[model samples]
Target: MVEQSTRATDRPLPLPRANLLHLLEQMVLIRRFEEKTMEMLALNRIRGYCHWNIGEEASVVGAVTALTENDRLITSYRDHGFAIARGTPPETVMAELFGKEGGCAGGRGGSMHMVDIARGYFGGYGIVAGHLPLAAGLALAADYLGEDRAVLCAFGDGATNIGAFHESLNLSKLWHLPVVWLITNNQYGMGTSVHRASAEAELYKRACAYEMYSEQVDGMDVLSVYEATERLLRRAREDREPSLLETLTYRYPGHSYADAGKSYRTKEEIERWHQRDPIRLFQRYLEEHGILNQGEYDLVERRVSQKIEEAVKFAEESPFPSPDTLFKYLYAEEGTK
Candidate 1:
């Protein structure tokens, strides 16, 4: 049997007014950044495999908000939203997508790979389930160093089927590593739906095998995501417990840029998800509570638009990395000092 997590309505807003507004701003920024990214791809400004976080804004913003600066984050290929939510400058993120020198990864790690270690964002890994072990390794490092940090490893439903997911979770629980396994279950993994792909579609229940704590949340609801992630983070930090959180989300677009998102899914199904769009849902919640009025919404839109424009301009003018630096970052070398 699957356990239901807290509903967005069961509790009052836990954050301050400014923080609530900031959440809205971050969601808006991610939405606009992705829209612009699609446009840039159309214009050939951004190349390579690009994934857009169009409908999953709440999942990114809410969870990232629940984290402290010291907490670490790692995620799968659909990562621009996470990077922005983790406070990576939109300009640098866009530059990274543009494969320019100013990007977060200095232009090498394009669309699928974004890393900002100083901010504790490990990066988005390209291979499915490949980063689970890395997340465990990071958590082990924290355990060894006796640091008070937790690691949030975000991946899609597809990864749950991989062997590494089980290995990571098993070790995490056995060793009591401070790691939260977040499954951003966007219904479909690439062209396949969870129902079609996995025998146990309710992913959080998979944690039962490992005897780890787990819960499923409304991924489209920002408050629910924040509350659950915050709870799990606290458990990881205070008790050295590991958990699996499954966010029931949907990706508005196709899995990646190349496919037209409509063929595999039905029009009615798409419309249904759109009606509960994470951004609009949160906006309504704010409006209903008198927290975000029309003026505030407009201001956020204007600001986000300006930021996206600046990012695009910066990416456009930035130079591609010179050929000489091609072999620089492949591996770390010992310092003579």
Candidate 2:
């Protein structure tokens, strides 16, 4: 078994030598996990909508790795890796996508709405930009309650243009809420490219409109993302400020699993991103640095692959939620009078 690096100090720092290895492991796990989801989708085992995290693994893993379990996470539809990195088990997440009773959301939320509140992952929202205010509100509540926890609210570039993005970011900044608006700018908002949709393509500047601190980083390099996010997240936690981090990345796969990475983006475009695949890049760095031998890296790959297989098996064997149990935990229960 791979040695679990749960100790925060023992875990890799944001460096090419150390943090890069953890980032690579996360990227590989996400890749394998998404591949399994696609296989399940093809077999009709996973119903409803699904988005591949194939290309955006670096953003989710890098941001979440900098956060503690107490920090809140809410994101848009493309959310599997975010959930996994935020502490939702692979089995529960897969089962949720599979619509089984064992799922984190009790099989109700389906592919675009996986939630594990215990892990502080509030939800994966299906409606675009639906969770922006929810995250901002979470930060507001945390502030009101004098809690030390911060919130990491993630979304795609497309949602960044929507009303909620503007409204929520403004609110968080105005009130100095403990929130980090982490936007994964993967060039396209579904089928629409960022250059076409966004009036000002440099989204981090949007934070300046709210007079919030902002940053831009190469999303493909997980080390760079972690370095930036760690600084911003710590600032947010310490000062209860709103920060915006725009990661310039690309999605090798299509907007959703239904679309097979074609149409707008050509084969050459996708192939280019494959050449810089974050997992492969860090794996190379790991081998060169001796932090991970080629043999050890292979072992990590095989172990995560096995974990994915077991998660699939668990999802396949899990039963669907019963009709009688529907709506059991949809909302918070009323307090006794």
Best by lDDT: 1
Q: Which stretches of candidate 2 lie over 4 Å from their true place?
A: 1-20, 330-337
Task: Put down candidate 1 lDDT per residue, 209-280, tens digits, no spaces.
Answer: 999999988998888889899999989988999999988888898989888888899999999999889888
lDDT of 1: 0.91
Q: Candidate 1's error at 86, in angstroms?
A: 0.2
- Pairs of residues clashing in candidate 1: none
Which lDDT value does model 1 have at 34?
A: 97
- How do the predictions measure up, each by TM-score? 0.97, 0.92
Tens digit of per-residue lDDT, candidate 2, span 201-244 = 88888888888999888677676677778888788889888899
lDDT of each: 0.91, 0.83
| Residue 42, model 1: Cα distance from true site in angstroms | 0.6
Off by over 4 Å in 1: 1-7, 333-337
